[model samples]
Target: MMWRRRHIFDPFYELKRMEEWMNDLMGEMQTAGGLLLPESTGKEVAPISRVPSIDLIDKGDTLVLRADVPGVDKSDISVNMKDDMIEISAERKGEEEVKEEGYIRRERHYAKYYRAVPLPASVDKDAITAKFENGVLEVTMPKVAAEEVKKIEVK
Candidate 1:
């Protein structure tokens, strides 16, 4: 009978397999153009710019959403509510700089972000209110009253 070799619980083998799987997934994503993240090379890929951090809270009678939008003017932000969805959009504009003597370096930052949040329960769109303070945007939406249950006779 020929000798047989069995290998089990090899840590490096599993790591290599995982690496191969991730490489395959990245290759497929690149081919389909679904992801615009930079590849292994230093070339820049463009698609989405940035995502503003947000926190959504669901209270018994209302839903609250807060977003971090530093360095953006309040007038540049827009909030809209439709059905059970709320969309928030904002743009940050860079200011023109005046160069002075012996200017070493200057950096300008600008970004546009948009996000849609779905509420767990129906909300009163017209009663929604929003406030912006200290670079944070807070939106409160009152939940709609639930329909009363009715008893039905069984046949």
Candidate 2:
């Protein structure tokens, strides 16, 4: 008879497998617009909350942040700055109606976005400026001047 190799059980093996499965499922769901749920009107719908992509750049005396918020109206976007943090939020609402030879289909979709960024340095909140153009929001914040350090000689 051939000798059989013994197998060892890992306590976290199942947990790791479950975590990987969950990650894959979440990825697929995000790409596929999430799981579809039946509506009261016998329609299948999926709710989506988009996380906007952002880029933060340090421009010496200023910090510039740019975020992509396509399909969102400028009026629906909000930017707030407090202390050393900045928050951005936006909402997009859309409705579509299609009429065929015998049936009409109507669909409505809503998506919201929110992001908060912490500044690496002190900023002049009162002088902050923001602009939205071409589905992109740009925020410029001026950095506060650093106080000069006086060197004292030790006796």
Candidate 3:
């Protein structure tokens, strides 16, 4: 038996509702010079998107950032640590393709994506390390330990 996808709707797919939503959005975008639509594709070409697939482990005086960067070139990825922010950027290869004879309809296409994460505190920027392997980018930043003891001289 084929598995049926369950949506927040009746068994019948309510396609018209989706169509109406898209129409409303596109209509609003038209005034903005159709900014959402790319000139090359003549359709809505969304910029690269990204998701946070990471873990933060507190190890006394350090932290580990494991980011999921699948299907991207490690060389193109850049990791930056400044003040209280961890910036990552990369130019992934576009997924445009050529195909033949395999469509009654063609929609739900995908485009590149980008994701950025902001750090909470000033990480020890000098010790930031990045490792990219098996399509995952891992960043390790050692925290600067705060002063545990203070000595005050009486004057």
Best of the candidates, TM-score: 2
lDDT of each: 0.78, 0.83, 0.64
Instruction: Give the true-structure RMSD of model 2.
Output: 8.5
lDDT of 1: 0.78
For 3-22, candidate 1 gives per-residue lDDT tens digits of 54555477877899999999
lDDT of 2 by residue, 1-155 (tens): 98544486665877999999999987787578754333332122345555677889999999999998988999999999977899988999999999999999999988877777888988998899999999999999999997899999999
Query: Can you list the residue pairs that collide in candidate 2?
Result: none
Worst 10 residues of 3 by lDDT: 40-49
Q: Quick one: ranking by TM-score, best first?
A: 2, 1, 3
Indicate which candidate wins on lDDT. 2
Number of backbone-clashing residue pairs for each candidate, in the order shown = 0, 0, 5
TM-score of each: 0.63, 0.66, 0.52
Candidate 3: pairs in clash: 48-112, 48-113, 48-114, 49-113, 49-114
